[model samples]
Target: MSIEIEMETTTMKIYDTEGFPNPARVRIALAEKGATNDVDFVAVDVMGGEHRTDAFKAKNPDAVVPCLELADGSHISQCTAITEYIDGHFEGPSLTGETPKERAQVSMMNLRAENGLLNAVGAYFHHATPGLGPDLETYQCAEWGNKQREVAGQTMSYLNEVLADNAYLAGNKFSMADITAFAGLAFADFAKVEIPQSLSNLNAWRAKVAARPSIAG
Candidate 1:
């Protein structure tokens, strides 16, 4: 069955810039929800400063990608918020979980994947390397950025331990946490932050997640 949400799916539009980690998270979630074909997907040229333009800023004050526009023209930014909305509003394979305890655990694991892996890799790239633009890159600190790379490595070890006994990041079920972790690892690869070969569990988890059609999107 197709995913069902409170809002009209035909009127939903997703503003996204492909290949980016955050936007990929939303795309994967949408795919998993079986809502990809229902929504209008607008691809913004993020590198071309399309996201920084005044018109885009009006849609999302943060001026980032993966902004979800509802039928009323209202927008929702941030991967976690957008994914949470999709998971709750839509009816399909439950990415967040059905039970209260399951939801809490999945949310917690998702946060860990987002902050510990994705954000850390992002910080390292945006700060240590040539960032988006001069206007945004002025505040970057190479030293701090390098430190975040180390932090990302440490987090990988911790996550490996978490996955050692469990099939997925949140537990047995393949949830949003797994998606975030997959996105994070992909981002890390883009940023040249290689996942240590020593992390066997995480490596295995990566292969499993990558095989999913949602992740391939």
Candidate 2:
């Protein structure tokens, strides 16, 4: 199905990092929507502490990646929000969902994966393990981080089971939920977490999603 929206043609700017999962999620969504070419990619130096600078904070108070700056001077932060905007405003296959029910299901699944899995992995990396850089001496959340990693791993196992009977998280059709799942799972690889072979269905689905031109690009 085709969607039509009467919006002016203008380049959207995306602030991203090279290996960051959150930004990659938005990139893949844009690729799925055929909106990549229309976007101006701006690399953010996460290691250089650019995100915490006053300039970056002005764009996103949270100082997170995958921030989308629309031509209308509106800035969008968070992968889910940016993906939904692209899916809603552009004319093409809908990434969020077509019907209200489908939309709700996809949104719910996406949130579950994010909160249960993604956040867990992030906690593991940021608090439990001194990832990217050494933990700041002032950081006092180490204990919680270790606990979060265990929870994240358990959630991943649960998600693998959930994907066993379904071709996609929401249904057979690809949606933003898939994007979030792929991003979260892929990031786990960096932290030396491997998907168990028992989750064959998830592995198969991930392979298919990764094969998309958007993902390859």
Candidate 3:
């Protein structure tokens, strides 16, 4: 896709690593909003410690991938913040939410998926497994990592329970919460965290989300 671009405007810039989980979230949001071609993408050499550099930190204190730079040169980091910008700026179905209740619900579910699943899996990968190798993973806490792995599994089960009644996270809409949870499951798969065979609702939800044009295409 194509999103109609305003005249004489500089395309916004996105600094990210392709195929990485968090970056994929923003990419999906862009695709969903039909704004994939509206911005310029700048690849960050994360494995080379590019994100940790002082220059990169100037753009984003967190030094994370999927950072968004506005046409005027202001920056927004963190996938959630970046997605919020995309959702509000671009014309499409709202990812965060459209109303007060919807927004609050989406935010709550997103955090659940982020903290309990995605971040939990991340903790396991970075702290327990040989994540990003020794160069980037300077500190490791195997015990804590192992504990988070259990949390990830438990979150998966919780999501399954939620999915039992709704089509997506935060209710019938495929909001930002769904995106975060989807990415979390993908991360879990990459980290070799076993998703139990019994969570049929979660598995079905995953299959549906995966088939969306933004992801399948």
Q: Which candidate has the top score in TM-score?
A: 3
Rank by lDDT, descending?
Answer: 3, 1, 2
lDDT of 1 by residue, 1-217 (tens): 8987785455688999888899989989989998888778899998778888999999999999989998888999999889999988888988998899999999999998888889999999999998677766768899989998998898899999999899999999999999898999999999999899999999999998888887664
lDDT of 2 at 215: 91
TM per prediction: 0.92, 0.90, 0.95
Candidate 2 per-residue lDDT, tens place, 138-197, comes to 363879877877777787777777788778898878899888888888878887666677
Could you tell me which 10 consecutive residues in candidate 3 have the lowest summed lDDT?
Answer: 1-10
RMSD of each: 5.2, 6.0, 4.5
Provide the lDDT at 137 for model 3: 98
Q: Which residue window of length 10 is worst by lDDT in model 2? A: 131-140
The lowest-lDDT stretch of 10 consecutive residues in candidate 1 is: 3-12
Which regions in candidate 3 have their CA more than 4 angstroms from the true location?
1-9
lDDT of 3 by residue, 52-77 (tens): 99999999999789899999889999
Question: Which residue pairs in candidate 3 have backbone atoms (N, alpha carbon, C) closer than 3 angstroms, thus clashing?
Answer: none
- CA shift at 174, candidate 3, in angstroms? 0.6
Local accuracy by lDDT, each model:
0.90, 0.83, 0.95
Clashing pairs in 1: none
